[model samples]
Target chain A: MIWVAAALLFWGMAWALNAWLARSRHSGLRAVRIAVPVIFGLTILVVWELLVRGLNVPLVILPPPTMIAATFGGNLAILWEDFVQTFLKGALSGYLIGCGAAVALAILIDRSPFLQKGLLPVGNFIAALPIIGTAPILVMWFGFDWQSKAAVVVVMVFFPMLVNTVQGLAASSAMQRDLMATYSASYWQTLLKLRLPAAMPFIFNGLKIASTLALIGAIVAEFFGSPVRGMGFRISTSVGQLALDMVWAEITVAALAGTLFYGTVALVERGVTFWHPSQRK
Target chain B: MNRILPILSVVTAIIAFWYAAVVPMNIHGVLDQAERDGVVVVPGTAKARRDFASLGLVMLNPGQAAKSWMQERPRLPAPHQVAIELWQTTVEKKVTSKRSLVFHAWVTLSATLLGFAIGTGLGVLLAVGIVHNKAMDMSVMPWAIASQTIPILAIAPMVIVVLNSIGIQGLVPKAIISAYLSFFPVVVGMVAGLRSPDAMQLDLLKTYHASRAATFWKLRLPASMPYLFTSLKVGIAASLVGAIVGELPTGAVRGLGARLLTGSYYGQTVQIWSALMMAAICAAVLVGLIGLAQRLILQRMGMTGR
Candidate 1:
């Protein structure tokens, strides 16, 4: 009963605060913009904690944030190993290979009108292949190591990166190409100097998208088969053991890793494509 | 003719590559077996000789060398083997049979459609609330976007178990997972669409003294049609993925996900490939249907440029 009251009061106060912030002239300020969502997130967590404790809900069904945080702290070693296996070994390696191959292939395809017509549909078809279907087969081929997980990531990330790079290669206008021709520039030289520069924004878009996909592919691949380590393996095994706290802990690791990976890619993109109109601000 | 020619050439090239790849990928296992039988052979030497010379140089029985490429449970199934399995399962078997790809596809499709419906409804409602109300716009929108950062694969098992504990089972839980995935795109798209009516349009409605609901239906709703259809395409594909993931943890005995799981368990590479092809086809069909509907709706609304 007390928790119910507290939850209601907190909700009401948060609503009032947000309403006030929304109406205020200062709402557009950077601090206020950040504070609004932060406060809202905190309120929801507090309410969730209160409701779970007050109702005596089973921890397996829903662990409070505190329990999740505690489990995360206590299991740092396990978490780190899982991170190394899934993120560094699986996601990062596959991301590099897949993105590298896609970029190279995209450039090759750009040179040939026949390839552009043929490969784009095939690429799209491959992209739509469900990761669930691919992950298990990959595990079989590559065994229970990080190699299989990386294979799945490569398959998952390849087509999206390919499609994006293909589109990006065409970003430069025909006039720019004609100008390059007038300068008597070689095909390779024109690609390096003019077209590649124009393609950076789209290439980075693909990179950022692939960053998330790589994490997802690596983690999900572990669900099929892994050598007793990795976020996905830990997550699935913990669920079977009914260790929901540990499961949530793995979720926390995966979420943080995903966000950091995406953020890093975006930061790099900004650095590389600063001159683009979209990144100008 | 031009489109078909390029596709055909690409497909032929891929088939050639697959056939060539099977020997290297599958021969390792056969060599390991032969070594166990006390055949004193070096690893790379044998593979290199096989690559350059005829199969006779590598093995007494050349047929065994050929057999490596066509093993029933080869590490990498040849393209034709998978194609044959796909044809047999999809065409020879009755749709109601457990072996039929159509049966598994229908199971997955049912959950996907259910979830897509729920997601589309919830997304539209939330988008409407966020667009109309200040608090929801400020609070809910950020959280909605944040929800996507947490991978669905990680959460799927937890969702299944938690729901199972509460006596909810099977299709409902899977549908919820699908809805969780599909809803976000819809929310983002619908929010953009609902707010698409410019100030001038709002002013015109205000000049007519129209009620908020009337103005919404008359001015805003029509403007959002293109965005809604665009998001629906993305949402439906995502919903299918969600359904497949939902099947992963439970190890259910039906659905395309189950086929993959069973195939992996038994080392049936051809079965896995067949399921993968079926899922891809299902996705293509779903997306095509959505595109067709989008065309009809947009044409009727006379907004075809989108």
Candidate 2:
């Protein structure tokens, strides 16, 4: 089938391009590395369009890539609404609350050994609780609006952020703390000048991780219960109606949102943690 | 100041807080669960405890004064109640009662174990291919990551319907979905693990005239064990997720996933929560078991955690 041939061709081109990019010591390898996936993806889409049309495969089993693009273009309104409801209403709120609360709590725990011992394991236990199980309970407790989705996101984002912040709080060398002590820096002053800055890289690691988790938590929570407007809601219901086009469109939206979310966090990370060794060129 | 008391007391206080908070959350669905199921029992004790918590504010101060008191304030069946329910469901039932949580959990466990095996095998194979060939590495890695970006919930129903339409009904469809969801982590982890052996190590092997296969088996594969086990821990959890996700669309006869859905539909919040607890426990136990295996296997290989 032309579809199979196109897929192979596209995949082969991607591989070849990637290998060339990796091996080449040329100045513009960065541009080439980025370009390879783009070119390969476009080629696949073109081949997919050709193959599906050539084979006359049923549109249901495998819609042409062009058709999927058309659907994505046509359904911008619903897609935007789903985006607002999920990303803006649920995920963003939860990520802010969960990550903010974690940093604050990490500071508190850092201040007291007692709090450190008691709280860390509890955070671990909560993190270990599967979202699939907790999502429904949260929906029941918080009601089936964006509130439940936000609650699930909170639970999902909380522990990773906490653990990371805790680790980051410890990131400063003891010698550095000793220098501050010799300088007679106050508790808050020492925290502000040294430890908090030192923790940025670890904090950003948690942020990057939680960005994906927040999106996932919001989406999965919608599956358990929702008010018919979320991306998760649309995807789940559309599939039941066997509307693959709409489903793929919603997926495209989710993919875009997830990528953007992660990218933004990574960008912030690069900015905030520029002094960290990992950021060094 | 630098002692365990702070940690112990803090945790104890939190537990006290959770107990206090949940006491009022009225999970009485637990405490009243026995009576509601028409099992022979004392009903008044649970109701009395609820009443005591609400009306017995006086009793609390007195208990605080006296150190302890009687008529243990009724909880949502307490830990003991849930344990009793677990027993009634798992060990006590003549096996396969509709009321049995174990029956539903078993339905899920079978699919989880099967899917995990298939998924892990597929992941390891793909990892091998990717590690060996530069071409496969670039081509496959991106697709694998992109595949995960599409939420599994969106894909689960399509998998169920498509597989059914193609005359592949029943467990195979669900297992395929699980396998599809699970293999990527293994591939990712294994790739990193296999490459962890350095150029110097590879050069040493080459100097000894080690064949490609010998070097792979002795150096690459063994070096990959830590990464493989870490991925397996993640893969096992992901497979369980796949199994649970698989249940949603297929209209399966049983599984913890099914119980959650049905319980939600029927307003059986307690049942849903109980099933979720069971699933969490299963995941924890399985991940722990993998961790144990990692320890034993790595020790045998003379590799410590470092």
Candidate 3:
């Protein structure tokens, strides 16, 4: 019961403090606002620890934060292996291939009206195919290796990247194209100079989106069938073993990877799209 | 005029290639025994003898050389064979039959919808909390982004078991796993949406002496509608993924995950393929439905996107 109280109290205080921080006018006050959530998170963790101890909540259901931290510390090796297999071997490889291919295809499709309608629909249809159902089949065909995971990632990231690139390539208005045309700039020169630059923001949007999709695809693909060392395999096996702390640890690793990946993409976007009105702030 | 013919030709060429690939089934001759220089070859010897074409013909015709093709059928079942199997097993049998994939799909669908609702609700509530607080904005935003890096696929089963030990049995735990996987996207999208109103809009509302609540409803809420719907559309797909991931840990007997497992275990490739196709269809329909809803909502609000 006290655990419940702590959770409620912590959440309530966090909520109140966070609201004030959001409304703060001063830039310094804004900085303080950022800590509000962290404090809230810490408070909840403390309450969770206290309440779990006080109320005797089962570790299986809600392991105290400390236990999770300890478990994470203890199982660094397994977590590290899973990270390499899923992130480096599977998601990253697929992200590169899928995004690269999509961009190339987007350029081709842009040059041809025939491809715009015919190819886009096919891309759309394939994109809509759920990875959960396809991963196992792909694993069977590609064998129980990272190749299959890459295939699944390819399938997952393809559409979003394709759609965005196509949109990006189209972003340069007809007026811009006319200007290039009047300059007698060769088609290749114009494309390299104007269209590609104009398309960078849109391309980056697709890349950012693909990062998430690639991560998701790699992890989900592992659920179907993977070598013994991948994150997916450990996650699946640990459940039967009832290793909640280890699972949380792996989760922490994955969460860290996802955040870093997302942050990198955002940072790149800020650099590349600085001229865009959205980035002016 | 220039484009249409090229597209038609491409389609025609693909179909022609498909037919040509299938026609090789007729070239059947068993090399069970072979004689290099007209010497009589024993059945068990390196030399093999058999009417391979007859076997291929029998397999293809299923009557002309049935005996020969029986040995050759595994390479690829004839289209008719698969078609017959599809009809007899999927169409003729009722969904309640033990053979039905629909029954399994229903199990997966149940978990998906259950988890989706829970995740979406939690996400909205969290977004609300994060948006209303400054400290939360700073701490929670980064944490939320970080939360996603940890692959849910790896933790879904663990979530299931952990929840199971806590006396949260059956669907709820699985739903929680799904919700855990899905909630992040919704929260992120909603937070972005909630903060979408420009300072000018806020200032305008202030000029009217509007309270925070009034400003939120009159300006921010309306502005964020499109963003929220887009996120919800994305969330629904994520939820389906969550539900599917939820099944891997428990190996529940009646869901699509179970079907995939059982099919793989038994090498029922056709069954596995069809189930996958069905899941793909289901996802498409779910996403399409949300898109339709988005269109309706936007149109109702007098916001039209070409």
Candidate 4:
């Protein structure tokens, strides 16, 4: 009861503080902007910890964040293995291959307006479909290993990457192309100098999207079948064993890995597309 | 009409490619079966044949290669085989039958629709709160954006199992997963939508002495329609995927995910292919319906471009 009251008081205080900070002139400062959300998140975690302890919620149902942290700390090696199998060996390899192929195909088809028109809609349609359904088929074909997970990631990322690259290649305006023509620039020169650089923003946008999809595809494909070492395998098995702490630990690894992966891609995008309007500010 | 020819040609080319690739994909198995039937197989030994490329096997036994498409469980089922299976399960079986793809699809669709509605409602409400309250905008918006980077689907099995242990079974658990999956996109989109009314438009409302409610109803909601529809399309597709994946940990009991699982377990590649086709069709139709709704609502409000 004391814990609950203390939690409630803390939550109320944090809410008031955030509200005050948001309305204050200093809220425009980067520090205040960052602090508000951090405070908010901490408040939730505090409240969750207190409430679960005060109410005596079963560990099997919802393990406390502290317990999850402990489990995460204790099982670093296992988590790292899962991470490499799913994220590095499966998702990363597939992301590179899929995006590379899409960019290559986009460039190859850029010369033909007819092919572009034909393929764009098809790619868009495929992108919106539940392509994850192919996971089981791919798993069967590639066997229950990291290879199958990689294959799933490849198919999942391919269409989105293709569509984005194709759009990116067309980002250069007609006037820019005409200027290249006036300079007697060969198609290859113009493509290399003007078009590919212009396409960086769009390509990066696709990469960022595919980064998320790659993680998701690799993990979900493991649900269909895996070699007993991937994140999905651990998650499903832990749940059945009612090892909610282990499940949460794996989830923590996944969340951290996903955020880092996406952040890396965005950071690279910032460097590569520094002159793009969206990146400039 | 001009675009139609290109699209048709592209589709035809894909189907042709799929058909051509099936023989090579399934040839090793096809040749193994032919050799079991005492047919002469090139390279003479199964051991030698195993090391040879699948395309070489296809070339060595052209007569047996056609049997790849007719195999009971080919590695890659032919497109027409999938189409036929889809037709048989959807059209031939009774809708109430467990074997019916229509029944399975309905099981999945209900959860998707229910979750979509809940998610869209919650997302809109949260967006409104974020937009109106400076505290929420500062505190919640960043986390909401960051949450999208996390693969939330990783928790689907855990969610289902936990909910089941708590005595909440069937569609609600699945719907909850779907809701969680679809929630972020709608929130982000709707936030952008509600704030889309330019400063000039807000100033006009202020000058007219419009109340906050009046301004919201008359201006903000209308401006948000385009963004709302775009997110809804994305949200619905996500919801459907969530529902299907949610079915997986339920142990091959029902839904499209079950079909995929059971097919894989039994090595029924044809069944898996048909389920995939059904899922694709469902996604297309759901997205198309949202698009149609967008057109109708936007047109009725005179929001369409002249």
Candidate 5:
């Protein structure tokens, strides 16, 4: 009861502080802007920890955040192995191959208006469909290994990357192309000097989207079938054992890997497309 | 009309490719069956045949390759076989029958629709709160964006299990997942939409002495329609996927996802293919309906450029 009361009091104080900080004249400062959310997140975690302990929620149903953290800390080696199997081997390799193929194909099809018109709508339609259904079939074909997970990730990322790269290739204005023509720049030269640079933003958008899909595809494919190691394998198995703490641990790894992967892509985008309006600031 | 021919040709090319790939993918199994039936195959031993690539095996047993398309559990079911299975399960079986694809689709669809409604409602309310309150905008907005980068779907199984232990079962568990998956996109899109009114527009409202609620109803809400519909399309698709994935962890026996799981377990390639086709059709139809609604609403609002 005391713990619950303390948690409630802390929540009120934290929210009030946030509300005050948000209206403060210094709120525009970068430090204050970052601090507000950080404080809010910490508040939630603290409240969650207190409430679970105070209410005596069962560990199987919901582990406290501190216990989850302890589990995560205790299982570092196992978590690392699963992370390497799922993210580094399965997702990353598939992301490279799939996105590479899509960009190459996009450039090839850029020369033909007929192919573009035909493929764009088809790509869009397929992208919206539940392409994840292919996970089972691919798992069967590739065997219960990282290779199968990679294959699923490949199929998942391919169409979106293709569509984005194709759209990006068309992003440059006729005026820019005409200027290149007036300078007598060859097709390859013009592509390198102008269109590709203009396409970087769109390409990065595709990359960011594909990065998330790759992690998801690799993890979910393992749900269909996988070897003894991998995040999905651990998650499903742990759930069966009612070891909710371990499941939370695996989820923490997935969340970290996903955020880092996406953040890296966005960072690269900012560096590459600094001149683009969205990145100019 | 100008676009029709290219699209048709593209579709034809894909189907043709799928048929051609089926031969190689299933050739080894086909040859094994043929050899068992007393028909001689080149490099006749199964071990010798296993050493060769699938394409080579197909070449060595062209006559046997035709059998691949008709195999009970081909590595890849031929397109027509999938289409036939889809037709049979959907049309031939009664809707109430356990074998019926319609029954499975309905189970999944109901959960999806329920989740989408809950997610969209909560998302809109949150978006409104964020727009109206500086504290929420500052504190919650970044987390909402960051939450999307996390693979929240990975927790579907845990969510299902946790809810089950609490005596919350059936449609609600699946709908909870669907709602969680769909929630972020709506919040993000709605926030952008509600804030879309430019300085000039807001000034106009202010000059008219509009109350905050009146300003929101007339300006912000209407301005958010196009953005709302766009995210709704994305949200609904995500919701459907969530429901399917939620079905997976529970080993639920009644959804399309269960059909896929059981088929995979039993090596019923035909059944898996049909369930996949059904899922694809459901996704297309749901998205199309949302699109239709978007068109109608936007047109009624006089927001469409045309």
Candidate 6:
């Protein structure tokens, strides 16, 4: 009860402080802009900790963030194995294979108007097939290893990459293609020098999208079948065991991995598409 | 019709590819059966025979190649097998039957629509708050963006478990997970939509001495319609995925997710493929409905150019 009171008090104070900060002229300043959300995040964490502890919430229902951190620290080796199994072996390999294949297919389709017209819709249909449905089927096909997980990730990432690359290839205007024609450039040279460069921003958008999708596919695929060492396997088992802290710990790793995966893709995108209008901003 | 000819040809090409793939994918199993039956065309080891990939070798044993397409638990079920299963479950059986695809589809679709409603409502409300209240913009908007970075698959089970413990079960729990997935798109879209009113437009409103409420009703809300519908299409599709994911963790004996799980468990590849087809079709229907509604509403509003 006291904890609840303290939480309410803290929330009220935080609300007042944030409101004041938001209204102030200096709120437009960069530091203040960052500070508001940071402070807001801290306040919520504190409130959650206090309420859960003070209210004596069951550990299974909601493990405190500190408990999650402690579990993460204590189970480094297991976590690391799970991370490698799911992220590095499954997601990364699948992402590379899928994205590579998609880009190749996209380029091939771009060369033929017939292929583009027919294939894009078909791709969209396949993309709409839910990951849950595919994961189980892929697991059955490839066996209960990271191979199956990779297969799921491959399916999940493929269409988006293909669609984006296809769109990106078309980003080069007809006039620009004609310019290359005037220069007597061959198809391959025009593709390499003009089309591919023009396509970078769109391709990177797809990559950024796929990075998170790959992580998700890898993790979710494990819920179907895995060799006792993957994030999804650990998460499901821990939940069944009522080890909420362990589940939270795995979630933290997943969140961090997802953020880092997306960030890396975005960073690479920035480097590659530096001249694109969106990147310039 | 011209547009459809290419699509038909592409689909026909894919079906042909799928049929061809079935032979190679199921060859090992077929050969294992042949070895068990003591049909030794190859005198060497089973490994050598299995590793060998020649269409000519498969063609030599027409019966065995045919058997690959008809395997009870094939690595890849033929399209006809899946189509037949889909027809049987969806049309032949009673909709109330657990074996029926319609029943499982309903279980998923109910959660999806409910969650989409809850998500769209919450998203619009939050977006409105963020746009109007500077404090919410500062505090809630960043958190909303951060929330999406956390993968929904990792969180679905936790949400289900937590909600289960509190005596919130079945449709509501699944709907919450669906809402979690769908809400982000709506929020992002609505925020962009609401703020789309330019400074010049705001000044024009100010010249009329319009109240905040009036400006919102007359301008901002209408401006957000196209964006809202666009996000709703994405959100509805996402919500279906979420409902399926939520079903997976619980191992619920109902829903398309359940059908996939049960099929995989029993090695009923045809059933699994049928469930997948059902899910894809559901998504298409949902998105189509949203698109139809968008057109109707926009036309009614005299925003057909948009």
Residue lDDT tens for model 2, A163-237: 889888999999999999999999999999999999998899889878877887898788887997998888778
The DockQ leader among the candidates is 4
TM-score of chain A of 5: 0.98
lDDT of 2 by residue, B1-306 (tens): 455566568667865665555444543433355446554433345656465443243333222221111113322223444455566766777657877778887777787788888988989998898888754565567767655444554567677776676688767777777777678878888989999999999999999999989999999999999999988887777777777777876566688888878867776655665777788888888888888999999999999942
True contacts recovered per prediction:
0.57, 0.35, 0.58, 0.81, 0.68, 0.69
- Please give the TM-score for the first chain of candidate 2: 0.91
TM-score of candidate 2 versus the correct structure, residues matched by position: 0.85
- Per-residue lDDT tens digits for candidate 4, residues A1-281, read 99889889999999999999999999999999999999999999999999999888999899989999999999999999999999999999999999999999999989999999999999999999999999999999899999999999999999999999999999999999999999999999999999999999999999999999999999999998898798999999999999999999999999999999999999998998889889866
Ranked candidates, highest lDDT first: 4, 5, 6, 1, 2, 3
TM-score of structure candidate 3 = 0.82
Model 2 interface CAPRI class: acceptable
Worst 10 residues of 5 chain B by lDDT: B297-306
Every model's Cα RMSD, please? Answer: 3.3, 5.8, 5.8, 1.1, 1.0, 2.0
Clashing pairs in 4: none
- lDDT of candidate 3 at residue B203, scale 0 to 100: 91
lDDT of 6 by residue, B1-306 (tens): 867888999999999999998997887777777778877655235677756764655765656787788887788999998898899999999999999999999999999999999999999999999999999899889878766666766888888887887898899999998998899989989999998888999899999999999999998999889999989988998899999989888788999988988888898889899999999999999988888999999999989723
Alpha-carbon shift of residue A230 in model 4 (angstroms): 1.5
In order, how many clashes per candidate?
A: 0, 4, 28, 0, 0, 0
* Rank list by TM-score: 5, 4, 6, 1, 2, 3
Task: Considering the two chains of model 3, state its CAPRI-style docking category.
Answer: acceptable
Q: TM-score of each candidate?
A: 0.92, 0.85, 0.82, 0.99, 0.99, 0.96
Alpha carbon lDDT at B212, candidate 2? 86
In the range A1-281, model 3's lDDT, one tens digit per residue, is 66577677776876676666655665266557457657767876887787777778766666778998998988888788889999999989989898988888888778887767666556655665666566776777688889999988887888889988887888999999999999999989988999999999989988887887788888877777788988777777776676767677777778788878888998989998889888996
Tens-place lDDT per residue, model 5, A228-274, is: 99999999999989999999999999999999999999999989998
Regions more than 4 Å wrong, model 3:
A1-30, B1-90, B128-142, B145-150, B195-219
lDDT of 4 by residue, B1-306 (tens): 789888898999999999999999998888888889999989778899989999888888888877988888899999989989999999999999999999999999999999999999999999999989999999999999999999999999999999999999889999999999899999999999999999999999999999999999999999999999999999999999999999998784889999999999999999999999999999999999999999999999999822
Q: What root-mean-square deviation over C-alphas does model 5 reach?
A: 1.0
Q: What is the C-alpha lDDT profile of model 1 across B1-306, one tens digit per residue?
A: 999888778878888988877776676566656666776555435555455433333343343466566676788888889889999998999999999999999999999999999999999999999999876788788878766655756788888878888999878888998898889989999999989989998999999999999988988899998899999988898899888888888888899888888888888888988898889888989988888999998899888834
